[model samples]
Target: MILWFLGLMVVGLYLSFIMMRRSLKRSALIIVFGIGVVGSLLLITLNDNAHFGMVKRTTTNEQTIYTASPNVQMPMLLKQPAGTADKHAVYIYKTDPKKKAVHTKADLAVRNEISRTADTTASLTSQTTRWEYQNGFYGALFNHEGAGQFVSQRNQLAIPKDWFILTTTQAKRLSAKLKVLQHPTAQQKAALATKVKAKAAELVKAEPELATDQTTLMKQAQKAVQQQLIQQAVQDVQQHK
Candidate 1:
């Protein structure tokens, strides 16, 4: 419908330009230029490379690069951990009326558990899913207690086949380990610290306000609480370890 409307508008505009061209000598160039600009805008609107707001922006070297949105471009199933294919079912369940788009991160654990328990169920087979607005959970049910299975179309990425379950202390230890891995010896650590400090100084030179407190320590503490709930993934090798 939108395409048809845009097409009609373009046709009308072109005809008007043609009439103007006849009235004004050598105005053919103006009409052609106007058509080209309009055509380009229409093409961009019809096939947006940004994938309809699914793309996210990541920054590097003062430039932004857009990456496709996982849920919009890729099948929902591809996001699942491997081998959990049999255990997890992805679906668009009925959303609660009171809460709009309130599928909190905590719900992911519940969804995982549900899939694990209902693995034997006939409907809980696939991992990839594409529940259109008409077929999604909210569309199916007006209230909250609605849920369904999600399946994958294909494996998206090669993730480690096993799981790594990290305790709070273990995660903290790994964070320290990551720092040490960057510098095996005290001498190397000192050198890296100096290099990092220099880089930080350069960044502050470019963006002087970065040195100021944009977020308070309390906000950092709150974020730490949320981070504690997440577990580091284990790879295929770690499964047998």
Candidate 2:
């Protein structure tokens, strides 16, 4: 009896120990799986952040976003197109007298001023400067400050005083008259031939036969014709280029 009792006790203790061991194995497996899932999520988040940082850095450093250096002491001209009331002539002139040459900005301004008619008064958002695009060539006259007298004296050629002292207003008027033939109205088309004849007479009067050698006049005419032909060809290419 004592031996049977001892054997039963030993069997019960062994069964309990086996059950405890199985429960511990199940708990350990669940904990290890949870740890693995958490680690994977953390790694994915870190990778995403790193990729975003790289994209931002590359975009911020691109050359397109960088500002180009501004040029203030450059000779620049502004050209605008007059309104219908003013006969729609093209206005060309200098904006800066200090600079002797036009720049990329000036070229763009000339085009914009024509289409919009606000070159002189418009405030460019890109750069803060007052650019004037009056009726005629602005050049050194706009920025003469104190050299007007000298410039006026130097411009005195043998031409008639009226022709020599041509104003911006006159230049604009001439440009408008020339532009009239492009897309003429009924009146313009009807009188085209007569207008051309009148234009030739006016040109002759405005730029009368200056006291120059006959040979020089012939050379000048030839050069002007050649330049016109070349310009026409270039314009054709630009229109179709």
Candidate 3:
């Protein structure tokens, strides 16, 4: 995209220079060239500013499963479980900021209700901080002084300053879905693997140029399917909830 923009600018400048040379009046040529240069420079500046602004926004919007203050220690449970140690281990999706703005009223009401309920539960005395969702995974961000003690006893897990503990039912559902995601049925895996291999073989046979990268292409396809399955699992949990 950047290359295309630069190419256009170069072509525009060349045309402008040609027009300046052919002009009858020197003052008119100077005025036109100056305006064109100024306009182009302004556009380039705005384009750069916009690009950087987007990069800044994207950086700030990056999501993580866990984050901790300097004084806090991260919990072990938040770590990826042994088997599901790939990109699909923890699905993280960013919500559209515009959609978030649109639903602010209803979301606020729900949040207030949860806050009130948490206030009443003595066991949940810890201050109820805001909840955040990345993809379908939900967790509350709270502050607790005795977070370490909670983790040691296994009474309640602490995730940095906030903890994400699932109810028995939620845990069961999450586990079941994750199992399907991490380890698809033998038949499912076999079918997809065979299809990918066959497609790659055909492509390589037709265009021998792609033969060298056949293995890489096949792995990418398999990885894509795995990611799709993981997303589906997340969606299932969200819908059921």
Q: What TM value does model 1 have? A: 0.21
Error of 1 at 238 (Å): 18
Q: Which stretches of candidate 1 lie over 4 Å from their true place?
A: 21-48, 53-241
Candidate order by TM-score, highest to lowest?
3, 2, 1
State which candidate, 2 or 3, has the greater TM-score: 3
State every prediction's TM-score relative to the real structure.
0.21, 0.22, 0.28
> Measured by C-alpha RMSD in angstroms, how accurate is candidate 2?
26.1
Residue-wise C-alpha lDDT for candidate 2, range 20-118, written one tens digit per residue: 566766566545544544544443353334321111111111111111112121111222335545333332332343434222232222222211222
What is the C-alpha local distance difference test score of each model?
0.35, 0.33, 0.38
The total of clashing pairs for model 2 equals 4
Candidate 3 is scored at a TM of 0.28
Which run of 10 residues does model 2 get worst, by summed lDDT? 58-67
Which residue runs of candidate 2 sit more than 4 Å off their true CA positions?
1-50, 55-204, 238-241
